[model samples]
Target: MERLSKATLPAAHTDGVTLPPSGWDTQRTGIVHMGIGAFHRAHQAVYTQDAFAATGDDRWGICGVTQRSDTVKRQLAGQDGLYGVLERAVDHTGVRVVGQVREVLFPAEQNAELMARIVDPATRVITLTVTEKGYRRNGQGGLDLADPAVAADLAGGEPVSAVGRLVRGLQARQRAGAEPITVVCCDNLASNGRVLKRLVDDFCAALGDDDLTAWIASKVTFPCTMVDRIAPATTDADWALGEQILGLHDEGLVTAELFKQWVIEDDFVAERPAWEKAGAQLTDDVEPFENMKLRILNGTHSTLAYAGALRGYPTITRTMADPELAELAAGLITEDVIPVLECPPGEDLPAYGAEVLKRFSNPALAHKTTQIAMDGSQKIPLRLLSTIRDNLAAGRNPAHAITGVAAWMAYVATPEANGLPLPIDDPMADRLAAVRGSKDALGIVENLMGIEDIFGTDLPGNTSVHDQLVDAVTALLP
Candidate 1:
């Protein structure tokens, strides 16, 4: 069987699959994106493709950068950056070929070429989907200099990691005459753009680039964004579904639910795609939307993940089916999360919470519990802890919020029944693993909270928070 590639695209059409129009075939690189994963492809890339189609602007095409490994790059390169996005519905799945990814480059491997593209004047906007951990931020949202990878990047040259590459690209642009650009963060963290901006500034300052920092300050704008799309990892089943339906074998196939959303700050220093034209809401302050999402959607999602994983449910649908996981999610949202959220205009927080549960209950999108459960150490701060801290500050017991954290602790401490360690894919896996070494629930709670980045100094020292977490964790233990 022939593998999917640009050469195979013409003949790749099948009954249920949709091919890119002639317009998709002719797009120029305008935006460069970091982290070419399912979320990026199914959400941002599809939006950009539609934005291009809507505006007839070929210059806004994406040049996706795969930061982790060459897996995505190899997958897309064979397809000439062409891929199919299957919008999975309860009844059926529909596939559309997204071609806005004009090129895919492995940043660490193709350093010079990657730098060249980023520094290119045509690249007016740089967007990132490199999750919360990619920032390597400490408790206070500054660069975690103690991190070995961060320290190595600081000591080295040629722009290695995400921050290094951005700093290097900005430095190049600065040298070539300060070019105005916009850097947007599409990650789920709060105030994401500001977070990335601060990290980049910290990275530059640590490397002693005062002049470059100044230029970046004057010429660049980092727009905070809130993006929502439940694009799960593409399993082999998703792949086979695509092949059986479309008759097109695509290595870069991705899958997502029928719903999509993008809320971006209207702040930009240079020209950006009319993403708003493609069903994205452009606003001035993303705080309300950002907090709503982080607290409600992400908070409960993690709740189901850790708690559901403990129950041995492999995917989200299975978890949501259980009365326990479902109640945990609804209770977390209604009791702990919703009270803290300021409903974005025209949005009812309660109704939104209901809709989120409805989306999670989608039987077709088998979002793996393990996938959402990864990075609990990194995710804990924003997803659960923020709610925990706020409710405590407001003089309410944060017991409901503590359940997710407790579940995480339980999940980490006890592996699957096979004597194999549960797959805890966190940047702080070693730190968490050590925390699990002690079977004491309160001790584990105290240790995890004390981790400055995860809980910050105040929460760990807060006796009430520790008490609540312990109680929550104790309830989960068999």
Candidate 2:
């Protein structure tokens, strides 16, 4: 099979997929995207392609920045920024060749190059899908000055993190007097836009660049977005399937669930892709949707992740296959999580919960428990904590939330119990590792909760919450 590129797209055909036109690359690179991961490829890139196809505006083509690795740059450039996203549904699979990404940049080697694009007047929109830890933010959602990566970034060397790269790019944009740009954050954090703005503000202050800080305050817009799609890390099988189905070998191939949704706060300084035409909702507020997705879908995923990992389930569908575990998640969403969520106007909260659970149980997408469980410290705060906070304030014991928390503590503290060394990947991995040697489950709870960054002061102060978490751990133990 030929490699997917401008040369091969004209002949590409699959049973259930749409291939972009050979002329798609004629579009200019007007969007600068950071953290070019599978999720971004499947979600934002797909939407951008549809927008271009709908309006024939080639100005929104994307230049993706792969933060720390040249792996994506090499793979994507090998295929001329062409990739395939196979939407794996339970009953069938669909494929589409994504072409919106016109270029890929490794900021470490090409910081100056990325800065040039970011500051270019044609680059009207900047978006990000960098995960929670990528922000290098503290518990309060501010830039963590204490972080070593952040500290090194502050020292003005080659950017090692996404936050640093953004800071540097903004600084250069300010120097060049570039026009205002909207920074859309597509992460799952609560109030993501506001959080990113805060981090940028703090970054400017730390550098003592009052002028840049003022410019950002007056000019930049960071729009919060609620993005939903289950795009798992592509396996070797997925790679082969892409070739067999599409008749093209795509090194940048990605796989995701058939379902996808993006809701953005209708706030921007300059033009953006006509994503609304591609089924996105542009609204004045993104909070209701953000809170809904975070606490319900994301919350249930974490529960399923930790619980399923403990029970020796490899994939999310395998985990959800167990009726008890499925009910536990469904019950958590319907009973504990939904009560705290303020569903948007004309939206059915319970129905949404049911749909989320149904998506979780999709057997076609191999959403790994280990992948979902990797960053518990970063995820727990947003996914489970808000509901836990609201439930406690309303005088309700949040046992379901406690189950997710308990599963994490066990997964981290007793790595050997599951027959393999847990791949602890998070900003707080070292701190968690230190407490892994704790003698008892309660000790693990006490020690981890004491880390103000993860648990916050309220959870540790509330003895009842600790007891409930302990009970959850006991229930899960074999």
Candidate 3:
């Protein structure tokens, strides 16, 4: 095996393939990130690198933490925290290794060390992409204090949940009289900051301490975010293709589209890097952009995730190639979703929608519908249901969004889709099955909408929208 070293690797993809050095520095930096997934690496870390390169200030270098997966930690360490990212598009592939990641820690392997680093005053920003289910909330949408891991953590005087760890880490920071660290959530939740705030409060309250809560309320900042990028999974075939193109053995390479966007509410309490230099939009109000992206791009993605997966499609590229699937996806956006979106100033919703469809259809990406559909129950509320509710409030029915939900239900109703069992990775999977087992689709809709935590109480009572949803869903069957 060729020893992976930046010195031996090609300088750029154009000159063939190259691997980054296997001994990059792992010194501490300003940012400590949780959930070291591909999206974070290709999107946020890429942005950080751009900012660093532009500003020449390495203050925002990232130290990544993975709660469950050791794969990222081990692979990154093996490559000296230097991994390559391919900017995949319909016509091209641009490969480069991002060195912004300084170090990685697995909670299981370095719990003490991880906690200490997060609590360190040097860590100014602690960001996360740990997924929705990682929050461990209950039916009431509050933190699940009854979760076994939570129970274990509390009983053993240890922190288990991400929120728990964050709160505990903050408490340590507070005890040391450190400056406040901005806690940014890069998840797909609407009002992500507020959700994180609630989790922080719930976690602190569970500890039976008002002082800690007060300290956090006074010190920490949880800024909600809207991030966009189309990062497909790294399949074995993709690896082989990468090797064929770039004559280097890569163990931790990820493929993503060249397009990317990160919109954040400029609400951090402490000092922050000049991320604007790196193309991040730090606006006073992120609602319009958030709403637009959630509805048009993410909402349409979810629609295809279930619908295409059910119709014998594995990847978005293949699904988009199918005339019927592609037409349905486009119609769902232009006709049903676009009318409901409120774009920010200077942003063309139609143009943005067009770009999203083009990205989804990009032949080089091979983005999988199954991957997009993994956490349907958690994602539907943010991406689809919110728009449905908004449309209903405006006295307009969201037929396409409703159809997407119905397709999602149909996808969940049967484990196997076109001979393969789609991997369902949602916290409410069992509950969704129980709800779907009802007599009709309306019964399932009613049961799902009745979850006050997910939709709030106002939506389930909207009889007209309910009737319209039932009607649209009924028409979807054959």
Candidate 4:
């Protein structure tokens, strides 16, 4: 019944449970990571630890900052920043203890310490996995100065928004004469790094701090990155499984599929981890890889999430087991998305998509459909809308892509599936509440499309797409 920690690690007797290599304790914190969630722990933290183990360089340890709550901090801090990444595949499950996260701090309660870490000269690179809504973007895809949190952050209160914290940290870094740092955005947004830079610029502009803005322009680098890994929300069952395997309670345990990848832009302002040694691809252009993953993997994920949740499939693995739903996902990639994408170098689109489908079918990974279905408004534009827009511009009907969009609409309108309550957990849930009780499919589609933030002005005005959405939503309604 002992909790997994540095002390318990020595008593571990499991055969396949990989421990962090020796000298892990000696590594100093060089990375300040925002949004320290399951995905970051399973993906980037593992890679970072591997980079350290690979080179014996102890300068890449991580200081993980939790954005919204102290739950993750509470989970990992007591464990000495040690956590198990349970890699769940159909045939095999493996656990690896990651130790690169040297410290965990909750920004809400420890903003001053978090800022001090950011100001520290040792913190050379800052990475983020804050989800789409965490950016607090306006409808125009810029920093939402109107947001109360953003306004408060601008007024010199403790920062609430991710951009606010990052910008404030950068301002502090500049004031302390620290070395320039790179900000790597690991979120699932198109042109994520550039988008983050723009958000920071907008924040600076709001403050009218021209000097700090220019300092950022000349000193800091924001690198676009393509990160792929399906780390699901760790359930009680997962914790039990971890205990069964490791003979210890792992509060910070995260479950992911067998696959993991990171493709980062080679642009950095200061020294960075030799991540290429840890199976990360460093390239001059991450756009091709970014777009590929966004469209094929992320787009299909949203589609399956909404559609599968509506059909009462609890998890993505179960959804993929359904013949019809599986085909719908495949068709969305092959018939709609792949046609619009320029294949990345050394990669085949069809093979990549096939692999993505394979990853989704991993039964051991209990990736809940409803979990992925959260924040449809924030996700749709980046995931499904781009494919819809591209196919429409080419004078081709993206029926599968449109189905994905319509599924979101149907999901919003439907309150339950198979007697289970389907909660609409979205930032725009208040605005969507009006359409929830409506029985008219066309009415729902029309109303949702009118929200220019998600669908944009062009899609709503297009009569053809509107008609398609209406029909799709009608068919999807129970």
- Ranking by lDDT, best first? 4, 2, 1, 3
lDDT of each residue in 263-355, candidate 2, tens digit only: 999999888899999999999999999889999999999999888887878889999999989988988997798877798876899999989
The digit string of per-residue lDDT tens for model 1 on 1-478 reads: 5666667777765666777656776787878898888899999988888888788888887888898889988888878888899888778678888888988888778888887887889999999998878888886779888887788888876655688778888888889884699999999888899989999999988989899888998999999999999999888999998877666788899999988889999999998888888999998889999888888999889888888777778888888999977988999999988887778986799988999999999998989888898888877788888898788878887676888888888887766723324587888888878765456887777777677777767877777767877887777754
Could you give the C-alpha RMSD of every candidate to the true structure, in order shown?
1.9, 1.5, 2.7, 1.0
- Global lDDT of model 2: 0.87
Task: State model 4's lDDT.
Answer: 0.92
- State the displacement of the C-alpha of residue 449, model 2, in Å, after optimal TM-score superposition: 2.0
Per-model CA lDDT versus the true structure: 0.84, 0.87, 0.77, 0.92
Task: Tell me each candidate's TM-score.
Answer: 0.95, 0.97, 0.91, 0.98
Relative to the unseen true structure, what is the C-alpha lDDT of residue 309 in candidate 4, on a scale of 0 to 100?
86
Model 2 TM-score, all chains together: 0.97
Off by over 4 Å in 1: 10-15, 417-421, 461-463
Model 1, 350: alpha-carbon shift in Å?
A: 1.5
Of the candidates shown, which would achieve the greatest TM-score relative to the real structure? Answer: 4
